[model samples]
Each structure stands twice: as C-alpha cells, then as structure tokens.
Target: MKIAFVGKGGSGKTTLSSLFIRHLAASRVPVMAVDADINQHLGVALGLDEAEAAALPAMGAHLPLIKNYLRGDNPRIASAETMIKTTPPGEGSRLLHVTGDNPVYDACARPVLLEGETVRLMATGPFTESDLGVACYHSKVGAVELCLNHLVDGREEYVVVDMTAGSDSFASGMFTRFDMTFLVAEPTRKGVAVYRQYKEYARDFGVPLRVVGNKVQNPDDLAFLRAEVGEDLLVAVGHSDWVRAMEKGRTTRFASLEAPNREALTLLHAAADASYEQRDWERYTRQMVHFHLKNAESWANAKTGADLAAQVDPAFVLAEGAAAPQPA
Candidate 1:
C-alpha cells in the first residue's frame, strides 16, 4: 500500500508521517519513507541525527539517471523528449518491489536502520537559494511520481510520503498518486479550512481522504473537528508530552511514545492497509498527460511538452468491478 501525509503547515503531518514510518518498520514491514515536502524535515522527524540526515541523497539530484532508467529499452521512447509520466516500461526498465531490491532503491535510496528494522529513506532535494526563479519544485515532485510509477507494492510492503503542505499539491498531478492521503488536521479553524479545500480537490481525483485530527487537547477540540469533518474523521490524536519532550531535546528515542499515540497509529494503519477502491490506470494516465500538456504549454517548451506526452503507457486498462469513479 502507498500512503501520503498532508495537512496545513504546522499541523504535525511530518511528525505523523515519521511515526508511521517507524511503525511500519518496527513491524518488520518493508517500507520506504519519502520526504516530498519542501521544508525537508521528515528526516529530522524520523529521529535522524543532523549530520546523518544531511548525508542522505536527494532524488532530484539524479534526474538524469532516473529519466534514463525509466526510459529503459523502449523503442518508442527514443529520447528524453518523448518520455512522459505514463511511458510504458520494457526490459531494462527498473521496477521496485517491496523487498527493496531494485535499481531505483540501489541507485537513489539511502538506508536508515531504525530500532532493529531497516527502512529506506529518500528525499526531494531542498529548494536552494540559487533556484529562486529558475526552477519549479514540481520537477522534484515529478521525479518522485515517476519513481512511484515504477513501484509495485504488495501486502508486506508500503510506501509513505510526506507531501508538501496545503493546496500546493494541486500544482501537479500528485493529488492523484496515493492509495490513501492521510490529512493530519489539527483541531482549529485554519486546519478545518485546509481540510475542506483538500477534500474538495481530492474529490475530483477519487482519492481517499482520511482526516486524522492532531493535537486534540480536549473533547471540545475533537468535537470541533468532528462537527467540521463528520464521517471522514478516522482518528483523533491527543496532545503528547512525550513528543513534546522529544521536541525539547529531552530525548532522542521514540520507542516509548505515549500509548494513545500508539493506539491512534494502529487504527490509522489498519485503515491504510484495508482494501480500498482501485484507480483506473487508463483514465489516470490520460488525465496525467492532459495535465502535463497543460503545464508544458504554459511554461515548458515544445521538447519538454513532447517528453511529457510520451510517458503515457498505451496499454493501460481499467480493472473491472473497480470502485465507481468519484464525481469530479
């Protein structure tokens, strides 16, 4: 299963994303935690020492290699200019299995041993001061999406992503990428507003948006979220002194997190791992290409436009008996 953590800024999405990675790893599940947020704090949230986290490689740094590998041996994709997001994979195209034994992981991923469980970590390189006007962060996000496109997750394996906060996800097709999008809303008006905006947008993509209330200090707080979000609320997390202590530098370990947090996480995991509606690959690819073309026309030149269009896989089919399409 693949999951993404998203919410308004400062809503604790990173903390929850990091905790989810720890939970999956500690359970002996094969997991990859992606820091797709521009802030790039998922590393520190995962409890990595500053130096160790700094040493991790950024996926955006290897865009050339990623494009090369993903293009693979396909005769149709003759040049990077023709490689689109949905480009079909042929022999030599790297595919990531849950076991973490693939060229993608080997080439771009860094190993982080948390507790006794081994988890792989990858980041979208932080936006630097030099990139102010010349670059779009979506390029890195595109790299993440391309990598995810090649992965095939099974029962024991999982992918967790810490997405950029708020409606910024809509800038690309990223809102459609995850099997589950865990919205970590705090019990506040601003948080609820973000929830409404995200939920409205995700409804168009048929994405499963589960609301997980964070920093619930009392019944009133929980009640506010419940009233605002209603049935979409999956779980509510209470304020935790343990997490506060960790934030204050009183401890470096997360093994002894408060029990309520653990319980909330367990419930969230159960929901994530549960069977949900499958997405239509054909429609998804087409919509992705449409967005690519739109983006290309607006900014990218002709060659980049062709490259984005070329990534579509012509053989994609919508699975029968799949969940009904969500109304756009």
Candidate 2:
C-alpha cells in the first residue's frame, strides 16, 4: 500500500509520518519511507543522527540514472531525456516491488535503525546553492513521483511518503498517487483551511483523505477538529514528551511514549491497513495515464518533440502478478 502524510507546514505531518514508519518497522512489516517534502527532515525525525542523515544519498541527484533504468527498452520512450516526471510506465518499462531488490533502492534507499528494527528511507534532497535561482522544489520531487509511478507494492508491504505541506502537491497529479493520504491538522483555523482545500480538490479525483488532529490539548481542540472535519477525522494525537525529548537530542525509547499517543499511532496504522485492502490497480493505472496525457498535451510534447501520448500502452494494466506489457 502507498500512503502519504500531508498538511499545513508545521502541522506535525513529518513527525507523524516518521512515527508511523517506525511503528511499521517495529512490527516487522515490510515498509519503505520516502521523504518527498522540500524541508528534508524525515531522516532526523526517524532517529538518524545529523551527520548520518546528511550522508544519505538524495534521490533527486540521480534522476538520469533512475529515468534511464525505468524506461528499460520501451521503444515509445525514445530516450531517458525525453521522459518527463509524469511519464507512465508501459510496455518494456521497469516495475518496482516494495522491499524488492532493485538498483534504484540499492543506490538511493538507506537503512535507519529504529529500536532493534531497520527502516529503509529515501529523501528528495534539499536545494543546493547551485539551484538558488534556476530550479523549483517541485523539480526535486519529480524523482519521487517517478519512483511511485513505476512502483507496484503489495497489500502486505507498504510505501509511506512524507509529502510537501499544504496544497502545493495539487500543483501536480502527485496528490492522486497515494492509496491513502493522512492530512495532519492542528486545531487551528489555518490548519483546517488546508484540509478544506485538500478536500475540495481531492473530492473529484477520489483521493482517500483522513484528518489526523495534532497537538490537541483539551476538549475544545478535539471538538473543533471533529466539527470541522466530521467523518473524515481519523484520530487525534496528544502532545508527546517522548517526541519533544527526541527532538531536543535527548534519546528516549518508543516504549516510554504516552499511551494515548501510542494508541493514536496504532489507529493510524489500522486505517492505512484498511486502505490496503481497497487497492485498485486499474484505477491507479488510469490515473497515471490521465496525468501523462495531460502533461503531454500541455508541455511534454513540445518539450520532447515527440507525441508523448504514444507512450501510453492501451492494453497495459497494473495489478499484482500482472505481466509487464510487451513492446508493440
């Protein structure tokens, strides 16, 4: 299953995402975590020391190799340079499995020790000095989009993404890529405002979004969240001294976490597990193709000097155990 954590900046999405990934890893579940946020703080949140986190390779730094590898021998793609981030995998393209051995994972994914278990993580990387004026942060996120585009994860396995905050993800079809998106909102007006925006935009696209209220200190905060989000409210996580200590560089064990916060994590995990059973590969493929065609018509065709729509394999369907499409 593919899950995303998103919300207003500083709404604790990254922290919640890290906690969820750790929870899954500690349970011995096969999982991969991708920090697709521009802030690039997931490694630190997942218990990596500053130096260790800095040493991890950035996926954005290897776009060419990733694009080339995923393109495989697909005749329609022409060359790796012609493939945009929105490029949908089709005939002869490489497909990825969660927890499977692949060159992409070998190069970009790193292991982070959480308790006695290990979690694989990848980051979209931070903007370098060279990118000061030339690049947008979304360009860096393209690598993550491509990875999710080709990935075929199983129900038992998981890929959790820490998405860029707010409605910035709606700038691209990337918002539609997840099986479930947990929108972490504090009990503030600005917090629920972002939720309204996401709900409005995602309504037509069938994005399964749930609201996870953060920093609820009293009955008022909880009531505010329930009134604003209604049935979309999944769970509310209270303040955590354990998280605060971890943030301050004072080490603490997960077992020492407050029971309520711990239960909230379990609820989030259970919600995500329920989504895994509802995976719809055909709809997933259609979404990929829809975005690919939209990009092709809008800019990719002129940019690549090819009719990029031809890249779509009409007969191709993405499903567990489905065969990769053959080149026409």
Candidate 3:
C-alpha cells in the first residue's frame, strides 16, 4: 500500500512520517520512504546525520536514467527525453514491484539505519542555486510522481511519501497517487485552515484524507482538532521529549517513545491498512490514463514531438496477479 503524509509547514508531517516508517520497519514490514518535500529532511528525521543524509543520491538528479530504464522496450516512447513525467506505462514498458529488485531502485534509493533497523529511503533532493528563477519544485517532484505511476505495490508492502506541505500537492495528479493520506495538523486555526483547503480540494476526487493531530498537549487540543475536523480526525499525537531529543542530535531509542505517541503511530498504520482493502486497480489505471491525456494535450505532445497518448495501454491494470498486455 502507498501512503502519504502532508500538512502545512511546521505541522510535524515529516516527523510523523519518519516515525511511521520506522514503526513499519521495526515490525519487519517491507517499506520504502520517499521524501517528496521541498525541505528534504526525511533522512535526518529518520536518524541519519545531516552530512550522511546530504550525501545520499537524489532521485531528482537522475530523472533521465530513471525515464530511460522505465520506458524499457516500449516503441511508443521515442527516447528517454521524449518521456515526460506524466507518461503512463504501456505494453513493453517496465513495471516495478515494491519489494523486487530493479535498476531504478539501485540508482536512487539508499538504506539507512534507524533504531537498529534498516530503512530504505529516496529523496527528491533540495533545490539548489542552479534551479533559481528557471525551475519550479514541481519539476523535481516529477521524479516521485513517475516512480509511483510505474510501481506495483502489494497490500503488505508499503511506500510512504512525505509530500510537499500545504495544498501545493494539488498542483498535479500526484496527490491522487496514494491509498491513504494522513494530514498532520496542529490544534490551531492556522493548522486546521490547511485541512479545510485540502478537504475542499480533495472532495471532488474522492481522496481518502484523514487528519492526524500533532503536538496535542491536553484535552483542549484534542477538542479543537475534533471540532475542526470532526469524523475525519483519525488520531492525535502528543508532544514527545524523545522525538525532540532525537531531532536535536541526541540519540534516542524507539522503545523510549511516549506511550501515547507510540499508540498514535499504531493507529496511523492501522488506518493505512484499512485503506488497502478498498484499493481499486481500475480506478488507479483510469487516473493514470486521465492525467496522461491531460499532460499530453497540455504540453507533453509539443515538448516531446510525439503523440504521447499512445503511451497508455487500454488493457493495462496495475493489480496483483493481473497479466500485462503484450505489444501488438
């Protein structure tokens, strides 16, 4: 199952995402964590030192190679440069398995130690001086979007992405790529404001959004979240000294996590599993085709000088045990 964590900046979405990833790993679940945020701090949040995290390969920097490898032997794609980020897979295209070995994973993802367990991580990379004035962060995020589009994950395997904060995720079809999205919000009007915005936007698409309250210190905080989010409130995570210490470079063990905070992680994981039962491969394929057509008509056609619509295989369905269509 694929899950995403999103919220307004400083709402602790990244922190919560890291904790959930560690929890899944500690339980011996196969999980991959992607930092799709502009800040790119998930590695550090997951226990890597700043220097070590900074040294890991950035997925955004290797988009061309990723595109080339995923395009596979598909004749619909003229070349790697012709494959835009929104290009959907067709017959002959490579589809990835979450727990299977593939070149794309080898080139971009790295394993990092978290609480004595290894967690695989990939980052969209930070925007550098070179990207100033000429590029948008969305371009870097395209790498993550493409990866999810091509990935075929099982119900037990997980892909947890820490998405860009706020409603910025609505900028592309990427927001619809998750089985569940945990919106982390603090108990404040400003925090719930983003929730309202996401709720309104996600309503049209039937996005499965649930609110996770962060930094809740008392009953009043929980009440504020319940009032603002109502039934959409799934869980509330209290402030934790252990997390603060870990963030400040003080080594801390997961076993030392506050009981309430630990329980919150368990709830989040359970909510994600529930979503998997409702997963629809047909809807997933339709979404991919819908966005592919939109992008092709909007810009990819002229940009690539090919009818990118040919990239969509009408018979394609991304589900377990489904046979992929062969090229005619």
Number of clashing residue pairs in every model?
5, 0, 0
- Model 3 lowest lDDT segment of ten: 319-328
Candidate that scores best on TM-score: 2
**What's the CA error at residue 328 for candidate 2, in Å?**
21
Expressed as tens digits, the lDDT of each residue in 1-328 for candidate 1 is 7799999999999988988888888778888899999888888777777787777788887877777766665565667555544444433445555563545566678878876788888998788777789998887777887776656565567889999999998887767767789999999999999999999988866788899999899999989999999999999998788778756656545669888888888988888877344545565556655665576566554645454444444564323222221111
For candidate 1, the TM-score is 0.88
Model 2 pairs in collision: none
> Which residue pairs show collisions in model 3?
none
TM-score result, candidate 2: 0.96
What's the residue-level lDDT of 308 in candidate 2?
A: 86
Backbone clash total, candidate 3 = 0
Stretches of model 2 off by over 4 angstroms after superposition: 324-328
Q: Local distance difference test, per candidate?
A: 0.75, 0.88, 0.88
Between prediction 1 and prediction 2, which has the larger lDDT?
2
| Candidate order, lDDT descending | 2, 3, 1
**For residues 1-328, could you state the per-residue lDDT of candidate 2 as single tens digits?**
8999999999999999988987888778888899999898999998888898888898989998889889988778889998988898877888877865678888899987786877789999998999999999988899998988888877778899999999999878899888899999999999999999999999998999999999999999999999999999999998888999989888688878788888888998899889877778889899989998998999889988999898888988877766442222
Ranked by lDDT, the better of candidates 1 and 3 is 3
Instruction: Compute the lDDT of residue 245 as modeled in candidate 2.
Output: 93
